[model samples]
Target: MILDIYKDALEYSAKDWKTLVILGVMCLFSFLLLPVFLITGYNYRVINTAVHGIINGRDPLPDFEDLIDMFVDGVKVVIVQVMYLIVPVIVFVIFAIVAGHFNGGLSTALMIIGGLITFILIIVACLMSQMGLCHMAYNDGAFSKAFALSEIKEVIEEIGWSECLMTYLGLVIITVVIASVVSIIIGAIFTVFGISGFALGVNASGVFLLGAFINSIVSMFIVGPYLSIFNARSMGLLYTMQI
Candidate 1:
């Protein structure tokens, strides 16, 4: 099932080169801020499509129309993410306070326990947010549906907790490996050329050098958006599995 999800996601992302390039351009201009919303909005469309397509059959990547609606959906996506993040933040703050009240070995023990608990909470928050985004898409962008924790939990149960966690952990692992490889490649290019200021993305001329250009090209147009869309498609398909 996981293999099929990835296979479908990869093919779906490349179904239309024009749409893919448009997404890439949006990512390239994402620093402008407005494009960020559009990018997120597009992701929402992909997930929504994936969920619905489970029965109706998959469609090509969604076209970039309806800018206003996309922006609103993007905002909802961000809100859902921030809402999920709050759980871990609250847990961390509480742990800090409780740990502060203790001293000596007890304090040390409390701190370690708090750290572990916080780590687990962070992972759980991330997993839940993924489901929350899918749930929001599954429900036609209902703002409250993203926060429907009970519904989300029930969906996860239907998917089976172990399978869900392992799938997410696999994503995390793959992401880490890709990021590490990109970093190493960038570092090697910088080191081999003995380039200075290239790493900073500009020199006295204030122009992008080889390293920065490659990094920007890879991140903005290539790897980053592909991964984002891929993730959305994968999770959306996973959400459909609950059916």
Candidate 2:
């Protein structure tokens, strides 16, 4: 199964490169929009007003300025951090459904549970492989073996667990640090200059737009694949150790 996974990944990368790229783009776009959607929905005033009116038997026509103020206040107070928890579960469930469709053994109720487990394991293996790659020197073998749990475990064991964990942790920390810095800079610009500054940065210098595009591309092609691989590798190691 591990070898077959590697073969499938390679074949998919080669024969269906366009499909993979499209899926990657779709994944990136979905993630980017997730926060915006949550924020808009959470801060929606019309629904809130209607609900309030229904409960109190009062007029639903709040003043426009008051509504706007309410929405802004809601935005400030709403726990947008809930998105962090929601998005991953949504993504995982979606991916699992897709995998079940592709694998074609999920029709039966009992089989659905098994299929979901397999999907979760596959995702974990992919993540392990990516972490492994980040630690090791750039090698085609690492990329090729990324989808294979068995091969990934072999590589990890050879390198030792302590080193692997340190490297993986370092990669995660670095990514988080960079993302934090970028967010802070963007937030500062928005604070100081407001919408006008944002427009100028996006339209005049094209910096904002360019940054968003690059971030999406990297998140899709680089980060997604690497994480998938790392997860696969890590799961394989755990299984071997258990045996």
Candidate 3:
């Protein structure tokens, strides 16, 4: 009966400021290539923990330790994601190239069709891949478990395709809202300060630019982990209902 995924995640995260801080720092550094893998792994780790919670009747938000294991798991998730989407991406690229060479209305039509196909395929791939990821985590990171199409389809069927679609749509809407709010707030801060700086003097503008950078980083540190946790928790809840 949880009506609000974002609210639930916010409360869960608020329970432990120390852990949130650690996750924030980790998220801030995750942009680097090496840590990117770990960050990816952490995503799976969150899903794994969520699955564990549903199955075991334990607390869902597990501690953000075990970087090495999370990194390894993350690499596998990356592979799953790539394998799922590569075909559609290739097709999209080919169509894009063809569209580029064409003229007028034909090119416009081709581009539109190509873009639509790519968008649909990407959504399908992500949903299926996520199911695969959840399964893989639940089964202890066996790479093969992630691609068990027959079993995965059964779970989807049991959950009802309509419900699954609704869940995906809901997830998208929630994520977009969260991301938009964060982006707007940060953007507004920068714009206001930046304008004031310019109005004051060149030196003030420099200071405002510096302040904007700091603000962006700090906002990222706060919002990034919160969204990650919210997503992980929401996915866990989704699968938990199926069981």
Candidate 4:
């Protein structure tokens, strides 16, 4: 199933360059602010507002003064997402009913299981991607890897359950500490020069934008490929452990 998804992605890549480019652009537009938050400071509301603006076709750019205003607006976005969760539940129920009616018995059960697994895989993939990105952002050498079954198995075997949990926790803590320190240093430099100083002297905003662009590049070139490789490695590790 995991390999099938990778194959589908690869086939999609080969057949749909235009779609890929559009996807890349959309991802860039939507997530460009993420690194900024990491580097500056995290305000959940600020992050929410940025995501809201991107989704709503509003300009997501922050003027220094509007930052507070945007943060305030972010709360509303959170409420909206909470409300939207109901729609998915309704859709899932409807689909399950239809499947039961048409297929019944073993086929329906298998279909349900497949859907569950697919959903789980997607969620795991996203979590792994986030973890990999955080690791890379802090360590520079930590590349993004795909959360393949093989990779998952490898992680379980080499690290074991206990060690895996500890490693992930450690990584999270380290990422937060590093990002905090970087933000403080950058903030101090900006303060010394002032916004005007920033405007005149290589603007912190420019640096922020450049870092986002670099991150996108890394995601595409390094993270995406490494994910595929890691998935295979994880499977191998899992097999070895099982044996």
lDDT tens digits, residues 73-163, model 3?
7789789989889878998999999999999999999999999999988987887888888878778788998889888788778877777
Clashes of each: 0, 22, 1, 8
TM-score to native of every candidate shown:
0.83, 0.29, 0.82, 0.25
Q: Can you tell me which runs of candidate 1 are displaced by over 4 Å?
A: 17-20, 55-58, 182-209
- Give candidate 1's error at residue 8 in angstroms: 1.7
Query: Considering lDDT, where higher is better, how would the candidates rank from best to worst?
Result: 1, 3, 2, 4
lDDT of each: 0.80, 0.42, 0.73, 0.39
Candidate 3 CA-lDDT value: 0.73
Off by over 4 Å in 2: 1-127, 131-150, 195-243
RMSD of each: 4.5, 24.2, 3.2, 20.0
On residues 10-52, what C-alpha lDDT tens digit does candidate 4 reach at each position? Answer: 2322333443343344345546654333212222222323222
Number of the predicted model whose lDDT against the real structure is largest:
1
User: What TM-score should be assigned to candidate 2?
Assistant: 0.29
- Residue-wise C-alpha lDDT for candidate 1, range 72-138, written one tens digit per residue: 8988888788888887788878878987898888888887888898899888888899899889888
After superposition, the stretches of candidate 4 with alpha carbons farther than 4 Å from their true spots are: 1-91, 94-204
Q: Name the weakest run of 10 consecutive residues (lDDT summed) in model 3.
A: 1-10
Top candidate (TM-score) = 1
Q: Lowest-lDDT window of 10 residues in candidate 1?
A: 199-208
